[model samples]
Target: MKPSTHLVLLLANAASGMAVHDDCKLRFLELKAKRTHRFIVFKIEEKQKQVVVEKVGEPAQSYEDFTACLPDNECRYAVYDFDFVTAENCQKSRIFFIAWSPDTARVRSKMIYASTKERFKRELDGIQVELQATDPTEMGLDVIKSRAN
Candidate 1:
């Protein structure tokens, strides 16, 4: 019999050797369900071979604060709860999954981040937008706004 699709996917994930910690999913649920946080920054712990939360933004935090949490020469994964007004003057919000791979980061770090991003993102259930950024300019507020619209 052929391997089931689910089995194949599970095997592929196991092969990657990177795990998303339980808290990562829990925090995402809080943001998605209760709106308790504005953003979450994730980092790969090379020693543990797991992805874990680095920082979390409070509900009152600004977008600039979220941007500041990302480092200048490192790779990170982040999720932002973006709130904006529509053209009709109605309130709207979007969950953005960002892969931050700055050009100056180590090649191995970037490669690992890139390869594991899809699998890691699957753990978050309600992500509405995805952005892969190589520099600050690529993920600037204007860029996120355009994508949200």
Candidate 2:
């Protein structure tokens, strides 16, 4: 896949307003955050095995504002940061694997619901390190690993 003109060749979390209907597979880490930002939308090109990372602006203080452009196609994933939040500040402020509902979305926010923050942090951190070490530019990592030349 040809990279986009505006594509930053760098880095990348969670489940939100997300429906449990689609068992969203964590697609290795598609992006890694080079600079700090509030929200992200990965426009996954499934056919081409590529993703376009969109670093969105913030005041991501509201759920609706944060999740307005969330992907529902079962391909791309969304991740967001909530470091600016202080009210119920506990641990995991990051959210990812945001699956949009086919019927009506049911994403879990750390702010609104009782959550498993550590697990999400572990996953996000691991992926961030993994991506930084070896950036996979294509979807054939498995195929290549299998010695399918």
Candidate 3:
């Protein structure tokens, strides 16, 4: 019998040699359990071969501020605590995992990010939505709103 898809993915991730730093999980727990952060940005440390926390948004930071933290020519992984109101006017919050691979980023960086995204995201336990953006416009407020709804 062929190996299961999950096993294949696990083997692929192991071969990639990119691991998520422990703090990546700790910070995500802070955000998910205590609302300590509005967003968390992550980057792959090429030298260390690990995905590590690059920056974090304060609880009061706006989505625009979160967007501003992302570099125009780099790839990053981010988790945002998004708040929205439903048609019934009830308040709700959702965690979003975003893969930001800008079109202008280096090809190698993009490939590494793409290959490692699922592995990194799996470490964060409470993500409610997932988005892959190749440009800022693709992840704009309107797009987020639509996804949240």
Candidate 4:
């Protein structure tokens, strides 16, 4: 093994590690116009298997009249929640959808922010989307788009 070869291998490995670490962030991507915001949720855990839409200005009570949605591997759901775009949480990370996987420790599931509700609905036909909130007083989204079953 040559010294130069070892050095190249080491650098490559380091770069790969960095890419994996930032997989959840999608640092190389940007939100498109009218798409709002987006992020990557590594995996959807069993306990929190649900996708909910928190109405604008609505409270986040389990018994609240909010909509509760679910997703299976064969089904796609449109998420339209505005509670996660705060200056605090949004700055730290971006997580929009959970990656449905069997591995409990799975990480990095890419979720895109498609442009426009009409386009989203049109493209994702046969899929029920979490309609965007129509009012204020709502800031929480219980997006349980995954299930254990």
Candidate 5:
């Protein structure tokens, strides 16, 4: 599939929402964090055809669980620093996560519920992550491996 196709799935999850399987909630959260951001730029390596995610923001919670759930073949890494910039009374914070696969991406097909924070702080204060399926082939590494067997 084309790179744009993968991007379309990411955008759709950001705009609407993703429906992730019960077993893949953690992976879905990781992808949601990567896809939806507080404005960031990506540098894709043409020769390797890999996407590197970068952002300028403050440190928030990490998605280690999400990363650990990824397929063994997929490379997952994230870095965060303090760079909060806000003018309103509501304090602004941000986090960045990325889910990159060598040949495909993960796609979800149900309305899954997720939150960054365990408890609801406020209506707008709660943190969330979601996963949406781009295509049938976008299942996480584990799913692919299981199906292959």
Candidate 6:
């Protein structure tokens, strides 16, 4: 007489993960929000080749007021959303655009207002940008050929 031993093994699907559906394929790099922090998002769609920018959480009110207060040709810092005269105040001022990285595709676009002149000077030295928001609820941005009068 001979005894036979049999075992059954089970395997899970390789694609399934938390919150991931079997039907939906894995996304390359998707933007995910963590905590709600006062930030801005700037987005440039490659497919459309269009630029859109907006602020999230809290509006840069201080920065807005500061820029608005500048007299004609008095804004020494570079302008992104608003158009200002650049003459005597700014000896060398230029707009800088930074491309999005693969991991940072979903980051919020924002610029913090420097409380002190030294902080403002530091900001001028390094111009950092975030992913522009596209949602209407966020912030509405119109691409104007010229700065709004």
What lDDT score goes with residue 26 in model 6? 13
Per-residue C-alpha lDDT of model 1 across residues 58-145, encoded as one tens digit per residue = 9999999999999999999999999999999999999999999999998667777877899999999999999999999999999999
Candidate 6 local lDDT, 1-149, one digit each (tens): 22221111111111111121211111101111221222223332223322223323232343344223323321122223222345455433223222212222222111111111123223323333322222222222332212222
- Candidate 1, residue 22: Cα displacement in angstroms equals 0.2
lDDT of each: 0.92, 0.33, 0.91, 0.27, 0.31, 0.24
lDDT over C-alpha atoms for residue 3 of model 6: 27
Clash numbers, per candidate: 0, 12, 0, 15, 9, 9
lDDT by residue (tens digit), candidate 4, 1-149: 99977765654443232212222222212222223333212222223332222122122333123223322231222222223334444522222322222222212221211111233233222222333322221223433322100
Tell me the tens digit of each residue's lDDT in model 3 across 1-149: 36676655654565378988999999999999999999999999988989999999999999999999999999999999999999999999989999999999986688778888877888899899999999999999999999997
lDDT of 2 by residue, 1-149 (tens): 44642222211112222222111123223233442445555443323333345435354344456554644323334454433233465443333334222222222222111122223334444322111101222212342222221
Candidate 1 Cα lDDT to native: 0.92
Off by over 4 Å in 6: 1-38, 59-100, 103-149
Q: Residue 38 of model 4: what lDDT?
A: 35
Tally clashes: model 4: 15
Runs of candidate 2 exceeding 4 Å displacement: 1-35, 59-61, 71-75, 84-92, 101-149
lDDT of 5 by residue, 1-149 (tens): 79977766665454232222232333323433553322222222223333333332222433333333344433232321112334554543433223233334222211111121111112112232222223324444344333322
lDDT value, candidate 6, whole model: 0.24
Candidate 1 vs candidate 5: which has greater lDDT? 1
**TM-score of every candidate relative to the true structure:** 0.89, 0.35, 0.90, 0.18, 0.19, 0.18
